[model samples]
Target: MTPYGSFSFFLILAVLLAPTVILGLQGKRFHTYNMVVSIVALGIIFASSLTQAIALIIFTIWQVVLIKAYITYRKKSNANTIFYLAVILSILPLILSKLLPFLSVVNVIGFLGISYLTFKGTQLIIETRDGLIKKNLPLSRLLYFILFFPTISSGPIDRYRRFNKDFELEISGEQYKLLLYDGINKIFRGFLYKYIIGYSINHYFIANLRFIAHSHFEHHLYYMYAYSLYLFFDFAGYSAFAIGVSYIMGIKSPENFNKPFLSRNIKDFWNRWHMSLSFWFRDYVYMRFVFWMTKKKWIKNRNLLSNLGYILLFLLMGVWHGLEIQYIIYGVYHALLMIAYNSFERFNKKRKWWPQNKLTHVVAIIITFHVICFGFYIFSGQLFHKGV
Candidate 1:
């Protein structure tokens, strides 16, 4: 029943698109078809199990109510208590879901899309408080945005304002055709990434690595390289499928990855890899930290403030991955890398002797790729596995 992993899923998706195609071509506007298709798609996903369905329903409703209420009150006065309470209440379900599992507790609140859904809701709440999302949107639209099944599980997280524009658009025949072309192209590419190449790399290389480690096989370090590429293709494949599906439905969702392997440094890699999440953290967390410190006159050194911001950003990123030690280390590793890169750039800025040619860029990319592969090893959590 999950997306992008099964033939049955695509068959179901195609079948579900009947209503959308009909309503879309009738000049009934985007919302008419968009709402219908979104509901049918979400209904299909949520209908598989009662527990997840209930959890998702409860979570969505809770956030909507909280957000709407907060918006109303925020118009009168924006108190810290109200804002924090609303934000905490909004994330309570996801917190419980994430924490309960780590405690060896029965995961009552857990659902497949809970993390992404909660992130969307929390963004809505924070942006609303900041007066960015000013309108008290319709409940149906809000639900559609949160439970937008195309990206419900994992995301190239969409912004409320950006999505609203597409929701309001009525596509021309030319535009619709272009959307179709791009959608199908991305979907085919996703097939290559996830089903073909991704599968081959995983089942052939990574699977064998486990056996090799236990056996007398040598040169086992190749497993790390294989795992890293497999990861890129596998998750990038899923993201491509998700984004492609969104396009077919008329939402130009932001991209997740952008030639990440070609990046020249940790700073450049973050900008390219899992771009939506990175950008989200950058704008909301990292930038905010810098702004807060700058506002309070806490530190006058611009470079120091920026470096500290990177630490805060990556630490939050690590914690968000989970409260695991390896994840924390992964975050610290990137933070330190970014800081060191920043310092290097500052030191090199005064020197006319530093290379500024394609050769230097190529060398930087090579070095950056290895560094990222090592980070991926930590992220893989294999180092901490008891059997390993």
Candidate 2:
């Protein structure tokens, strides 16, 4: 019953989406219907495990109470301690989920999509603390936003305000037609990427690399490239499916990938690859860290602070993936890459040494691509697992 993983799921999805399609094509709002469908879809998704389903319900109730309490408190005052507590409580479940395995405890607090749901809840609390969200959100709307089935598992993490805008939008027939076309197209592309190309690469290429390669170096190198490509297609494919479903339901979930492999620099690559997640870390984590440091007057050198922020952000992102050594190393590796690239860019800017021509751009792309693939290699954990 994995999301976007089977024919039965797709069949169910088509049936559930039928009402949304009918309403959307008629230039009407389908928010209520969509919400009901989301609940049903979530029920089916979690139905495989009764414990997980109970976990989700308990998690949802915790979030709702916390958010309501915070909103009420926020109306009277904006206390730092209370805000911090709210944020921590919002993420406590996810933190526990990540830490429980290390302690040999069964994770009763964990369920599918907890990470993403925490992200949404935490963002809402942060925004409320910042006064961006002045009014208390409706419980139903909050639940809908939290439980939106399409991007619930993994996300092009939608912000509370942004999602609300789409939820409230009234699509015209013309607009709906365009959205319908685009949604279908994206779903088709996802099929090609995931079912066809990604499958072929994994089954035919990556699976056979060990037999074909004569040496450890060749085998690892080929695996790195193949794995990197496989990851892109597989993840990008899932993103497309989620976003496409969102579009059909009139939500317009953000795009997650661009021409990531063609990126000319590490920074450029981050801006393109897994864009939604990168931007989320940039906006909520890195930017906030820099702002807090500046406000506290802890560091005067902006560049030094920025570099530190990158380190913290990536490390958190890595730890978010899991508490694995390879994930941590992957984070540290990317932080170093970003810091090194920033220094190089500054040096090049001062000297006007790096040419910005078509040829150089292509060369840059090649270099950046290899660098990224190597990072993916670290992320894949093969270096530690296989001793390669």
Candidate 3:
């Protein structure tokens, strides 16, 4: 029962959340209800078709065992080699999931929420290694953590600690009322965004995709705009519904988008768009790469080090999307843009005559938006793409 996509799902979820809200108003923690509802929702989804469901179950069991073992091991020793091995074993199934399709096998290991869950599990492993999650987690609680449904399929990924904090909070009547109102409003807004305008644009794209694919050189502005809007509204709308449902349940899930189109630069755009995923990449991949390089004295110059990090991070981002030429180009394109932007900033600082006013800001916004739109064109696999 996905919270973001369907009217019936919301209706059903609203019924479940009603009792949860009632408990919260009585100053009680509804953690058990939340966990049970989440499990039931996923159970209802995958019960009819147990193939994918079995994959998810196996993956979950594997992750649970790996994390539990790691916690046990960490209690005894923090050996770097064993820690890395444990991390690899935890994510090995996910790696198989992504690669098995190309290996001419059915996607038996892959599941809808695999990537997001891996991120959470990987974070727990890393944090446990760093002494953040100090105590060992029981199997049941860890299952609750990994299977928390609202952000499962597509996430404005919430951290384990944050989810626990919200789970334990007792909402006042006033706050509960406000949360109910805001949550309903957000669900309605998501409906408008995902179904109404986003679907319209998506339909338009489907009708014209073949046309654009055939016509080699005619610039299709409409398709570009349609796809961009569809992408934003659909995913952003899903995020809104997820977050809204979470708020109603007193979870206060992290936000995913924040007026990304108004961003003045590529960096600014990332800060606003699909923010949870972007920040995850930055925090885990980019920052770690830079720190390692700095610590090893591999690259003394900071800017060069940063540029290298950007390449590796975005390259991983591309590979993560898929092993497609367009996806790879998309990642490299952004990496180069960021590198050039950094260089330009360095140069512009020396020459202070460059305009730094409202007009310049407006101009920068326009340029950045177009740049992003062009990138999306690449991402969509519509530009010079060889097709049947």
**Highest TM-score scorer:** 2
Please give, for residues 104-195, the per-residue lDDT of candidate 2 as tens digits. 89989899999888988888888888899889899999999999899987687889899999888878988999999999999889899999
- Residue-pair clash count for candidate 2: 0
The global Cα lDDT (0 to 1) of model 1 is 0.84
Off by over 4 Å in 3: 1-3, 204-219
All candidates' TM-scores?
0.94, 0.98, 0.93
Better of 2 and 3 by lDDT: 2
Query: Candidates' lDDT values, in order?
Result: 0.84, 0.92, 0.82
Best by lDDT: 2
- Tens digits of lDDT, candidate 3, 1-388: 4445566777778787778888867766677888788887788666666787898898898888889888898999999799889889877987888788867888878887888899889888988988888898867778887987877887888787887777667677777778778877887888888998788778866466766555634436666766787889999888888888887777788989999989988889989998988888898789988998999998999999999988998888887787678889999999998898888888889997567899989998999988988888888888756642
lDDT head-to-head 1 vs 3, winner: 1
The order by descending TM-score is: 2, 1, 3
Q: Which residue segments of model 1 deviate by more than 4 Å?
A: 22-30, 210-220
How big is the positional error of residue 260 in model 1, measured in Å on the Cα after superposition?
Answer: 0.3
